[model samples]
Target: MKGRCDKKAHLTGYKAGDKLWVTDPTAAAGETLQWTKQPVPEYRADHPSSPPFLRYGHTATEYAGAAYIFGGRNEASVCNRLYRYDPYVDKWSRIAHGGMIPNARDGHAATRHGHCLYVHGGYDNDMEEFSRDLFRYDFREGVWHACALCDRWEGMHRDFHALSTVGDKLYLFGGKSDELEPYYSNRPVYDNHLYVYDPAAERWDRREAKGEAPGGRRSHSAFVIDGKLYTFGGLNCLAGEHYNTVHRYDPAANRWRLLRPHGRPPPVRRRAVACVHNGKAYIFGGTSPLIGSPMPAKSPAEEEDEPPLVDHSDLHVLEILHMAWAACGLPVPRHDGLETRPLLPRPTVGRRRPPARPKVRREVDHLRRSQSIFVRQRYGAQRPPLSDRHQ
Candidate 1:
């Protein structure tokens, strides 16, 4: 959907497991967030019966036709159930579940390459303990098994490290390391270390770096495009600030370079999810520090200027080739690569029915409540009376 340019972020909307794309709400009709002429659909679970919900301690990775979410802490407790979302059906299915199930934890890392999903360290319920044991999930056989941790990284079990796959190997860089001894603090820090896991050899190799790498940090997001790893936005350990800088790592050269991101860089935010589709990177649903002190008024002043709105729903996209970073954004000197295409599609299922308005829930009226109460909860609260708000 086109939106006003004044808004700084783009966000996605989800209904019944279907995710829809829209321009930044804060952008002007033609100026601000400009969505593609087409919208892409994200995968949904096999079962659509469950109300849409967000849970913690879960790890999700996108593959051919499904997004797999497994082993996360929900409102209830740490769960081992495995759920797969199908973009075609717009539903979720709980499939086979058996792996070297690690202890229940959150903020872990999941990266898929070839056929296996590599699971890494994360925090436990207490938020004190961190796990380092590595697990592998085989998609072909639907089995989870533990793999050996690098002898070099044997001591500390950390979570929230930047996880990205380059070529057939997986690279994990910088995150909060777990404390193994009582004398040390189990706090998150900016780790400068980089480790590579070779699935073929089933071993971790510490890369020999010749240049600067992204500083030690956590909750940052990273994804691979055309064999290079691109990362941006994450929380650093400090009074509280989100990063806006972008960086790329080349597995071939064993080096890193900061890049100037394309589109409007998303506001400095942390703990957001980002994905690569059709050679572009899309990020959404993150929290950032407010730019100024919040006005104390209970509500907006009807007579004064309108206050800006904020939510964790802003969506941002980076056409990787359009991004102008040094050593980035250039056409290949050769033409041997595969033709690019979008990984997902726009959803067609679960269409929205026009609001059965004229029915209001005002304390003084009852006939205006003909539609389901839940629908009102979802869209009615923000609009004025139906007559005036309808477009």
Candidate 2:
């Protein structure tokens, strides 16, 4: 008749710590939030189902009780393959279809409405250009349909943007564009504009939002909860800026309000995957430069050997209704004095400390000596002196 207990276990049914962590709206103020990592399913080597290759910038949309993953780039090349994951069976199956298949691309945005998946703009590496076409996959019919690029949608080409479905419409927001003016030399230009797509009428409308917007960013994650759209951490490449801030947009008011949620936030990053399940926003893997650490200009060999940014494998959850953040069993990194500091102190884009003058002079002299030796070896006595070469 006694209840069971485990001393080392974080969850048990008998004690206060035994209860499962929940984001209940009516929970007491002192309720603790915890994250539990789910177990990965295993299968035999000969099994028919297998996982997709490691990738990023792909679209994963939950539709009809399964997750459908679309095109993304891997180390070798971009792909246009589609795979479906069934959580109930813990299996993955590649889907084969016949229709106007999309090009192999990455950085595209996708969303599900009803039973179909809508995929939009991405960069096609093979074509060496950004895609502006839209494609739709009808789950019920098992066919892919390419939507016509109407004249009105001509200037809406973009990649690394967020797309979310609200009611019967789709809302697209901030992303980088090659057509936009660069904020600094040799850097990407990002946009802060909002666009709405009406599938019923096949029309696109650009909405001019009021209030202080989160200006010009790309690779940010966004999701909709209770009719409001919320966006999180993105990078402003042109300004050499990264963000960990959160912003909420109310369609009814046509306004954006920056939200300062309670608890420690994830470090500044972009290209993170975010989704809403049971009123909580879960954010996963992304990339960011080291905090307060900027690299100086280096030689081409050094630049090739060292990476400028770091990739993250941590997960963080945000309680939407409560406006609080929780981590998944990992210690949240602290950004000391970040909230009180201005962003102007950060490194400017396309700028870095030059190498010491003496080092440069030495490199130049060495290059000249090497060239003079090569000329003497090739031409022998016919070669001119170093001082007479310029004359």
Candidate 3:
């Protein structure tokens, strides 16, 4: 959150939609925001039928007034196409690489500083490999450059992990070397270590995170505010479990703390993305299983198909000012900061609300409320927006 403007900011977001949207934290509470869907340019004038590039597992970062998106996949394969979206112009232009382009990949992470766009670790299909190389996309020069890796570890090649940037440092949290496949008897293994790369110092440090660290996970999301790192919701494939917890790490203190708040909480989910606007963390879409997975469902009717795939489109805001969670909707025109009341929570279009939960004991009754919905003292809110179960 250091070096961040204290006013008039928005969280840039992209997901199931092939376009972009942003959350203006300055808007009045619960008032729908006015967002425009931009036009994606045609690669060729004659190719009018060509589908626009829509992606997940891709990385988009704000740099020098434009949003730079790189490396992701569609239904059939991975992609290496780099794009720039200039909000001022409401247009998206593909930036062709002059020389060699890095391998096309998805599930990678990227961040920007100054004019440099840093991309690292994603699953590359062309080589049938996971990339260990760090690539820099220099907008000023319109060129692609690779960083010199030092004492590389196998972990550097992982995808689906949480990669975050703060200052000159790039930090990677828990990830697995493998993704889930139907017949792989061995479940995915997650890394418990933390890797920090100081591009300025030209250094990489792999060290065990101290204190009570969360278990290894993948497809999780993280963001930095005021120099402290905050991580949220992820999947533990080995156990087929998803986490709904929030953890905060203070590097200066080298410790972790779990945040349990009295507010509407989102449902357990994974692979969702997040951005920090104002001083709050806004989390968006990610995939989750309708039910815990490992073995198929016991019901023969349900066993005929795979577990329901949950891709959420709902918007959620976690006030960094406080740790409380609440559901958000489309943005409205600029206004003063949202007040505590005057908001109506709703998931994105066509999302079926999560099934009801079984009753809990009296002692922990306060924790089950939806975080997106504004309830009483003890609350809970909406979870990720639902997606196609078949895809």
Q: What is the C-alpha lDDT of each candidate?
A: 0.53, 0.60, 0.58
Report the error of model 1 at residue 32, Å: 12
Q: Write the per-residue lDDT of candidate 2 for residues 114-139, one digit (tens) a residue.
A: 88888888765444345677888888
lDDT tens readout by residue for model 3, 1-391: 1011232232333343433344445656534444433334544522423333655677777776666667776544456777666656556676766544677767777777567777877765444345566787777888888776734555455667766776678877876553321111122447767778887776788765677677787777888898888888887654556787888877777777888865887778787667776577767665555544432423211213235555555567787676678876554311233233322322223434444332212222233323212332133211221232112
Predict model 1's lDDT versus the native: 0.53
TM-score of 2: 0.68
Better of 1 and 3 by TM-score: 3
**Predicted candidate 2: what Cα RMSD to the true structure?**
15.4
C-alpha lDDT of candidate 2 relative to the true structure: 0.60
Q: Rank the candidates by TM-score, best first.
A: 3, 2, 1
Better of 2 and 3 by lDDT: 2
Q: State the displacement of the C-alpha of residue 101, model 2, in Å, after optimal TM-score superposition.
A: 1.3
Alpha carbon deviation, residue 45, candidate 1 (Å): 14
